[model samples]
Every structure is written in C-alpha cells, then in structure tokens.
Target: MARSTYVSEFHFSREVRRLSGESPAALRRRIMLERAAWRLQRGEAVATVAADEGWSSAEVFSRAFRRSFGIPPSRVGAEFRLPAPNGLHFHPPHSLWLDGNTASADIPALMIAHDIADTGYLIGRAAELSNTQWRQPLSPNQVVLDWDGPESSVAAVLCGTVWAKEVWLASIEGRDFPSRAATDPASVDARSLAVHHDDIGAHWSAMVATMTADGRLADTVIDALCDPPESFQLYGIVAHVLTYAAHRRELVRALLSRLDVPTRPGDPLDWMRGN
Candidate 1:
C-alpha cells in the first residue's frame, strides 16, 4: 500500500489509523466476520462460512463471531450489521449502506409533498381565471372517475384533484366524507382548495411519515368507508392517491393553458428547483 500510494509505510499506517480509526488488518477482519454473520443468518453451514470467510476452523469462527456479535452464529437473526466507527454497513449482494446518511430524503413522502404543492399552485393559478373560464367545459361529458362525474372543466378537475386527498384522508382518519363548496367541483374556488389542501396535506404527510417510520406500511386497515367494507394497506392508499393526483394536475394544467392561464408543464424536477 505504501509503495502503491507513494508514501512511507509508517506514514501510511498512521494515516490509515487517523482516517478509519482501525488498523488495516483489524478492518479487514471485522468486515470478514460481519460478512460471515450475514451468510450464517442466510442458513449457510457454519463450517462452510468459516472456510469461505478465511477462518482457519469452525471453532475459531464461532469464537470470533460470538465476540463480535455477542451471539452464537446459530442464533443470528434479522440484523446482520455490527457497529463500526466509519458508519459503513455491508448491504446484501455486495453493497454498502452508510448509516447516518441524510442526503437522500424519504422518496414516497417527497412524491406526496410535491403532488400537494404542485396541485396547490395550479389551483391558485386557476383562481385567477374568470368564473366563465373556470367553468367552461374543455371536454364535454368528460369524466376522470365514473363516480366523481364529469371533470370536464378547470374548476371540476382542480377541485377533484384536491378532493381525492380529502376523501382518502377521511378514510384514514376514520371520519365522514367532507362536503360543501370544497367538495363541489363546480363550486369550489382556489381559496377553498388552498385551505383544504394545507389541512389535508398536513394530515396526509404525518400519517404516511408515521406509518413508514413505524414499519406499518404493510399493516392492513379495515376501510369501512368502502361500500360493504374493504381492507387496504397504508402504502397502497398513498400510492393510489399520488398516482391519480398526478393525472389530475396535468389535466388541470392543460385546461388552464387552453384559457391562456399561465402555468408550467408541472414537471416535478422543475417544481423542485423553483422551491
């Protein structure tokens, strides 16, 4: 290493210790043991793992594994990771998961947030249009959802987009469906949608974040709100909402653009940049 890196052996050793807080040999041994623990959890034979990980014997591997993991190899569970100062974790299939890395945001939460913000922006822009333009049908007898009736106008499409969130949130919150001007596509204005969007967006974001953090996304809920009742997964409901909401936003954008109302293409990348 010293010759390859064009440095003295002593200097190389010192820098390795300073940077990694472990001598080179110690790092290699710890990583090898961590890998062995992972394979053992996958039901690899102890003797095979011992040899594959370069341990001299099964007994030697067992002692080392016990010392590092505080559990016998046979007792290994779901957790294969061991603590390390460098925050490096061996992810399965030869990858590294860096602990404490915050550069990446929770993706599903981000999609939900972007949808909320972009929908709100479009609604606000739609509000500036004349009532005639807002209600003027862009596609006659058009329907986005069979039950929601015709989302053929700016007011209808925009309001329907917001209402999708309102309706699902009601189910998640175990409450009755919301009604009034905000729920009425033809009647709902930008101000109504804006206020309701914030309210629903907060609850929606919180619910998803909580459920995700608690590892409850797979947990099922009895959605009595459905006719005759049905069950839904927490994550499924979120994906459903975001999927259709993306469509509604684009529909609104097209409707608004037809009226010469100013708007963007509603690209999430551009939306992210603006914010």
Candidate 2:
C-alpha cells in the first residue's frame, strides 16, 4: 500500500510540473531553504537546522545551501537580513536563488507593472471593436441584462479590476475609497472605459513607485473580511491583485474571441519571456 501511494504521488508531481512548468520538488526545496534561512537567523545551530530540514548531514546541507545561494549557510544570518519597507524580510539566498544577485526589492514592482500593462493591452483590443461588435452577446445563450452580457461583462470585469486595485491602494494609504457610483456594466461605454483604464494605470504605477521607494511591501494592512477583522500583509494583497487581474484578462480574451474580434497572445509566460 505504501509503495502504491508513493507511485501515485510521483505521477501527480509529474502532472503538476507539466502544467505549471515548474517541478513540485523545486518549489518545495525553495520553501524549505527559505524556512531554514529564517531558522538560522534566529540563532539555530547549523546541524539542528539541517536535520530539521531533512538533510542527511550538515555537510550535505551546507553544500546545497552554498550552491543555491552562492554563499555557505554560516553567512546567511548576517548577509541576508535585509527587511523590506513593508515589514517583510528577505534572506540573501532568496535574491541569489531567484534573480542571480539582482536587488530583490524591484521584483514586486516589476510584476505589478507588467500585469497592469498587460491589462491595458487587453483593453486596447476591446477599444478597437466596432460598436455593434462591442455590444454583441458573448454567447447566443447569454442572458440579457446579466453581467456576462458581452458589453456589460467586459466593462464590469475591467472596472472591477480597477476598483479592486483602488481598494488595495486606499488600504495602503490609510484612506477610505473615494465615492463613485457602483460599476454598472450595462451603462459603461468604450470612451468611459478608456478613461477608467488610464486612471487605473496611472494610479497603479504611482502606487508601485511609492511602495517600492518606501520598502512597504512587507507591511501589514487590516482586512475587515474576517470576524473582528484580520491583519493581511501588503505583499499578499499584491499577489491577490495579480491573480485576479490575470483571470479577468483571460475572461476578456474569451469574450473577444466570441465576438469574432482579433485577439493577441496575452499569457503571463509570454510576458515574462518578453514576447
């Protein structure tokens, strides 16, 4: 039974790699190394940290750490202790492991900027559609007046993306969101949508610049989603924004395809590779 389980796990890991373009083992190793670095920074002994990380021996662990981080495990405590302005901390190995020694601070801002630009690209595609094409139903069966109706759906999703980002920016600034009418997809037109897109892009770029300059990506913001509210990290919010924007962009692309409009490749992988 144990042998069967191991085989199943191995196959599952392979499938994950096929889909994500990254092996599960590699991701696990990354998390493990990050945790181990944090432990070492707390003054944990090398051998204990190695054993805790399931390394067969301290020597093996040290060698792996040095290879991954470009430095031996002993030096991690002193060299990689830079704390981001947002209260998040980074170990040197993280930057070395991920970016080959580039400053880690620019990573988040770069990711956010890319996502915003990608969304703008999608919106630009939408703007080129004829009025009839823009208003056409995404599907013959799509319900009239529903949010998914071609014209309304596209507007709502794009507006929601902007609104969500604005919410996070407001949270970061310790201010309430300015009053605006609730997003009405049915009423949104291409001209107004273009204006909203520009506004959001400018706001997002400024926010990224401010956060990067202030080093506040690791800072905590209060999330009122839970009972009595909960503390949410700033980086977590940015991650959520990136994910939501990506999903919405795909939906917009799908809608465009249904409308017989020309679509361009907008995959994140394509963006990462500078396509």
Best by TM-score: 1
Please give each candidate's TM-score. Answer: 0.60, 0.53
lDDT of each model, Cα atoms only?
0.82, 0.69
Shift in Å, residue 83, candidate 1: 22
Best by lDDT: 1
Tens-digit lDDT track for model 1 on 55-165?
889999999999988998999878887878887667787777767757676679779889988888898898898878878988888788898888889888877887887
Clash pairs (backbone) in predicted model 2: 85-215, 85-216, 86-215, 86-216, 86-218, 86-219, 88-218
Superposed Cα RMSD, model 1: 9.6
For candidate 2, the lDDT comes to 0.69
User: Each model's number of backbone clashes?
Assistant: 0, 7
**What's every prediction's RMSD, in angstroms?**
9.6, 14.8
